[model samples]
Target chain A: MRVIQNEKLRTVLSYLIPFVLIPAVVIGGIAVFRSRGYSYLIFAVSALTILLFVCGFDRRKTGTRRLVLVAAFVALASAGRAAFSFIPGVNPVTAVTILAAVYLGGEAGFMIGAFSALVSNIFAGQGVWTPFQMFAWGMIGLFAGIFAKYFEGRKLRLCVYAFFCGIFYSLIMDVWTTLWTYDAFNLPFYLASITSAVPYTAVYAVSNAAFVWLMAKPFSEKLGRIKLKYGI
Target chain B: MTGFGSINPAAVFAYFLCVTVSGIFTLNPIISVISLAGALLLWAVLPVAKNKRTHIYPVLLTLFCAVGNPLFSHNGETVLLVINNNPITLQSTLYGLFIGIMLSAAVYWFSSFSLIVSSDKIIYTLGFISQKAALVLTMALRFVPLYIRKARQINGTQKALGLYKDETIITRFRGGVRVFSVLMTNMIEKTIITSDSMAARGYSGGKRSGYPLFKFTFKDAVFLAVTVFLTLLTAVPQAKGALDFNFYPHIDITFYGVSSVAAYTGYALLCLCPSVYEGSDRLKWHYLISRI
Candidate 1:
């Protein structure tokens, strides 16, 4: 018997099922456990597994060379944040996330940004804010992906783009953090936002400039060669 | 991959069912502790590879959440420290810690469940969902990195052509936007092409048969039975109105009696036993494989 199978049909189903089932299963498990603590852990683990599995499939596409590249990218993207945290006024996360978006597109940018945040948080610790952080960083990557389309690959342009991306990233994340923890339309919100804006914004600008200046040209050129070679 | 301890998807489904039913009505500390211990024991006993450092993140998060709670809200009795002329009550902090711990435990257990249960099993259990929908969900999950790789490749190409310039803030912003638009356009085009391919294959015509590699065995029945029993036991505290939740005045537990705590503990232990059995069997498989 012939089974009717469509690539698109399968693709659609694949995406939808995990998105719905992941949250559903997690929420359901939380209810049974009656502990929000356990539920959040499960959510993080599940998301991580799903992302890793997806990356594994991607590995099959181009063999070990590409797999290594992807892994390196993820590792750098993840470690970059921690390193940035140490810098006097640098926020590597915003810079890297923005760079991922500009180069990778929305889905990949979102995944890398979110996954990097999630993975990094293992050191930072997991909490209710884990998801929020993931969403925030993920948005940065997504916007970058959307934004990357307009820019031409030039050193001067990249530096400027990275700077603004940094600023946007800090502003958006600070707003989200404020909303999540604090009440709306209040003094707390105003104080939290402004206070966070200074350090975060300054760090973001410096980091963006540093990353764009250092990596933009060679990285872009290498990526271009790979595309031509693969004809993808 | 064969001979690894098998997990019954049905049992897992039932376990989740039980958790959902019980968790909504009460946040039972005893149950939470029991579940936490059971999960930890299973993790310890399981044949799966261990990464102890990975545990740090969850722990840190719990502490952060617990400590941060007081900074936001100030309520409850039993004052402890007076911070900046504000009463930092012992009750509130303790309560916060308890909630944080419970939340962390729950998250850990869920993550454990994900590790135990494979996605294939998830698909099998959720077979009732339309094939089209299922396919889409899996594809999206699968596509995250693929899209990233493609976007990066495109960006690299643009840079090589000297089309990209990093100068003024506005110019860079403009360049970034241009890259994104191109990527999005490509994605849309690819999506349409994929959709067309699906349409041609009669994807939406009617019902589709599912092909599961494994069949239900007697072990599955036994597993389901055990999980169902444990699920019921976990739910008893909620059903009997014995489960207590105190957000203030120091986190305290007054179980119906000693019997309830014992029963909960026993049930939790029973829930954890199977992982041991399965894990051992998996170890044997690995041993044989290595020898071969």
Candidate 2:
């Protein structure tokens, strides 16, 4: 029997699962672990497990070709970060992730984005924050993939996506920082965390926009060429 | 990857899980200090973290976490200072210090972990879970250094051919994009060829075998037991309410009973075991060399 695969279902599940599941899991863990240290670990691990399950699906496209393309993007994104190590917030992971999702598929995009964060954190330093990072980047790719048609060809649209995704990344991370700071969330503490994070979030957004504006068009052109040349 | 690195990946993973989880969950200021000290010492002694002058970032971050908490969070009883009519409470300030130490310690532990467990170990460990994932991770990890080298070589060739000028910002940008395209094309094509070659070799037909590099030994077992034992020792007191720490309303720790002291000692040993395990080997080796 053929495995159940529906594009629309995949799209809907991809978008909905992360939004619904992560918060639910965190809330669940907070009740059990009391939003303390063990709770954060449990919270992050649950998110990664759920996200990985979502990504662990068989694709009907060019098969291993998609994985290779993803590998290329992971390397490109990682090396881009390494190459541009001078600037603190400037990296092409988000743009490259979006471009990959747009060109390839959401599954590959999520895999590449999440895997890049996993592998790169080897050098960048891994922590309890790692799973949170992986989920954030993966969701960014998944979202980019779902909205690919609208943003792919347009430079302005791509830049806007990158900037917002960048802010979104920081915002997700800020939630983790908040949980870590107080062990659980209260309205005032979380708001304080968000406000404190505003400066860094702005930096992240601007850097993302600057990189996407410079790189997305040319990178997409190259991605298209490879896709055509190899029937990928 | 020897000495402390020789420990089995599973054991290392367990050690980190216990220490990091316990460390984060309990904000006992004493435990935080010990974790910070142990982590910093391990980082300094780690073979791979030699060029870590970038440690200034974590130091600054630690300071920021320590100082910044009081400004935004003023939910404590004891007023430490009043800056701009905002009462900076003692609880928040101390809490901030605890967080700063936790973050800094976590950073050091992470650096040391990265150094000890290279990608091959990750691949080897992951092989047991899912072969397909392990293979992909291996390929991606291998591709990174390879692609970086090729990109550098291409950049050199482009420079030599005078195809791209490095003088102006726009020229450099144009040149970088062209180089990036070429690199992507080469890497992706190479990946396809490699996959094809694997297909020809009947890669999917047979179960792939990992190298017998890492084997869990009795020593690993003992080390693992010690870490778990320490964690269990700490857990007993944590259950007994001796390890409780409150930060928001007021900075308070439970009474330092015999159990608390035992827990602190156990936690310290747990954190420092890696450094001692690695350092002791060096000490013996150096003593022999000096004798010779």
Candidate 3:
């Protein structure tokens, strides 16, 4: 009874910790960044916050079976990036990760998303930008997982969600780019980047939506069956 | 044996961590250019290039980074050109190029860094944190290329079987989707099968241990110290505002003294470690073989 209670407490803490920590970290980072104009410490703090969230969530919730499945999903997502290398901004990684989160578990989605970025960068080239990619994709998967039930059966809704995720991914990356390019995140530079990135963002959105639209039926059919079989 | 690849994983990680971080942090023209040159040198020395054409990605990325800044940002006093009634200033353009160089150099350095560390080393690094997660991440990264090949095979087989013979664009798209779905379903089943096998073999039996490929060496220790030292030398000048360069209102660059020059040279050496290590080793090996 004590063991079970301990486990339940850990589960609740995993969810609760991020809820409290994320806002506090964001507010603190913004405050520092605002005051300092530019600081490596600011970037480090935000990245640390995300890394903390991922590690904490993984530590409490994940098990061997789930870990293996997450690995496979991440591998599959990375392969999607490689397969679509010629097609700029179109990869099924995000869509597949979102669907996995919805069906398997949210944390699983987060794991898959975060792992996929680091893994894909092995082929795409890893850099200072890697942690940012991990954070961006990880958060996307988290949100998708959180709202998984709403997107479970609704294909169009899920496609729309994936589209937004694509734009969001690019937007976050652009913000990172600006920070890297200009030692500071100047509002004017950021705005200029966003305007220039519109076409690229659109391309990303369309490919993401297309993949989700095409992939949802067959991919989810298998996933739905697996969920039924494993009861995961 | 003293090649960059043969160095201790920890030392390689330390060196890469130092240069890449410093590269990302500093944006002075002198520093950025030194970083770019170092990066280009490393790329030239490293055997990452299979085809020369593939090198265009870095070139184009660098070019875009360097070129894109001036076009969008219309800051600075010295007007160079007026396009579409917009004034382009020399100061902002130069700043843009500086940024581009920094970005490009960072990109190149990272490319080599990935090769230097590799995935197993990454797993090893992560293993210190969580054994299970590291193993899983390693396995996933390993599976990516295999799945890519499988994807291509599935794609080719579909085409050969008259699956994607649809002439219309939409149907072709649908056909492509069908292939992806089939591919994913097949792969997922395989994943489940593998997991089932692992479970049957008692995956949760006890603690797991890897092959343990990396160990610290005396040379690596020395290299690690040098990397730390050079990185510090580079940082000191920046912290002192000696490497500061500004644009927007007008270009203002104030050089402090010999320390700034030392800082630039230090960064240059920091970036060149791998190439120097690899290059000198090759030279010595050739000389010894000739003597023999």
Candidate 4:
């Protein structure tokens, strides 16, 4: 594993790839390609975004304990998803991700969320939806990490966040289905899709809140102890 | 891992990626049908587990997409029905059918992909980008089964101690949660020990390289070359609008010129590539065994 030796180049590349290059691919495909078929472009962009997030995690000089903890969190989240598979649209993945982000920081949160999606899908089945799932959950974790201060000791706010993360995940997935189905974001089709998915969204959102309400304190206490004991 | 599955994971990944992506993005009914049929054919040829319910999801999805489209988008000239003063146009319905086929085709392709490209291959593919990400993924994959086993063990211990009950849904749920919390504490504590042992073993001591389980051979190259060539054959003319299709305002399909004809042929052959390869390989083996 060759670490990027130059700090300046690593920073520039990280910023440039996501902000500059990815948008260019989307804009350029839409503009120059003129919609012959750009669903592949959507797939590429989502996949590349996931790759970028993973790369961002890799670039950090994380301690071994932290790395192993990230792996454990991913396993836990995936196990939660698997355990709750009997119930449709109900999983503790989002709750676990938010907890991890709040405790382990944003990068670890993203890794757990993204890899949970990936690893669970390995058994549940991968599809066109897999990348979007990765992107959506990864972003939820990232934002949770970014806003960890507001969530500190505020279980109510955390529940609200988890609830919205549910809706956010569904809506993001709707964006993919619309784009994949129509090759364009046809508004009527998009709205219809969302309307059809409303029940799923509601169930998942409520479940997320419930899971957070149940698990937040225990997770926080356990993670805080581990952090203090191991200096992770 | 013989025949098609034996190919290098990277090449196999590329093949599925290309085939599924093209199958998905194309809107033409002819192309969609071809892609769907090709996917089913490959799936039939592959040694995949199947039950009575195997076809249910894709069938339901196809039907939903077919019926769901015209209910929302009332475009096109051919009015099939009128519902609440909104016209259900034939074009929209047909578009829905095509889109459904396209989506289900991608679904079959992915199902086959999962069967072919196992998790280790997925990790191998990921290793190309970020080794640490791959390592994390590997460790996480390892931990899932271990945690599941540990969770079961914990549940058993609780049951043995008469501390667990599952007579009702609430009790079951509570028991599961208790087990999960216990597992979390156990995992966190074990994580420290695991990391310490890993560091002692020089897990990240210096530049680490992965052991190569797969070598890209001549078959991989040939496989990739054929896939790329066929993709270009379809994509080039597709870019030139030879495969352009319209269904909203009117149902219009591109006239098959020489290039478009070749493009369609290329796509059909590309879709059949896997099944044909597998079938011929089996035939060759049969003949070799007969001679022996």
DockQ of each: 0.06, 0.27, 0.33, 0.50
lDDT of 4 by residue, A139-222 (tens): 899899999999977899999999999998888888878877777778988888899899999999988998888888898899
Ranking the candidates on DockQ from highest down gives 4, 3, 2, 1
lDDT of 1 by residue, B72-132 (tens): 5567677767788878776656655655555555556555555565655554553433332
Expressed as tens digits, the lDDT of each residue in A152-226 for candidate 3 is 888999999999999888888887777766766777778888888898889888888988887777767888888
Clashing pairs in 2: A37-B25
What is the per-residue lDDT of model 2 for residues A1-232, given as tens digits with 9 covering 90 to 100? 1111344664565555556866665554344234274546645674556355434543223356666667768878887767656456667788778878888867777877887887787767777777777788887888788887887778899889889998888877777777777666656767877787787788779878877787777667867887788777
Write down the TM-score of every candidate: 0.55, 0.82, 0.84, 0.92
CA error at residue B191 for candidate 1, angstroms: 3.2
Winning candidate number (TM-score): 4
Docking class of 2: acceptable
Off by over 4 Å in 4: A1-41, A184-192, B160-171
lDDT of 4 by residue, B1-292 (tens): 7778888888888889778766776677888899999999988888656544657878988899889889878889999889999999999888888888887888788888888889999988776556688888889999999998998899899999998998885576667778888999999989999999999999878856446667878989999999999988887777677777788699877686887897789899999999988888888889999999
lDDT of 3 by residue, B30-107 (tens): 777888888878877875443465467667876776677777678888998899998888887788777777777777
So what's the TM-score on candidate 1?
0.55
True contacts kept of each: 0.02, 0.33, 0.45, 0.58
lDDT, candidate 1, A1-232, per-residue tens: 1122464665565576567756765655544434333433434454444443343343233322333333334445544444334345554555556654566566556656665665565444444455566766776666667767665376677678778767766665555444333213335544656675787577667657866776665457655555465433
Computed on C-alpha atoms, the DockQ of candidate 1 is 0.06
Which portions of model 3 show Cα errors greater than 4 Å?
A1-50, A183-196, B47-50, B54-68, B81-86, B152-162, B257-262
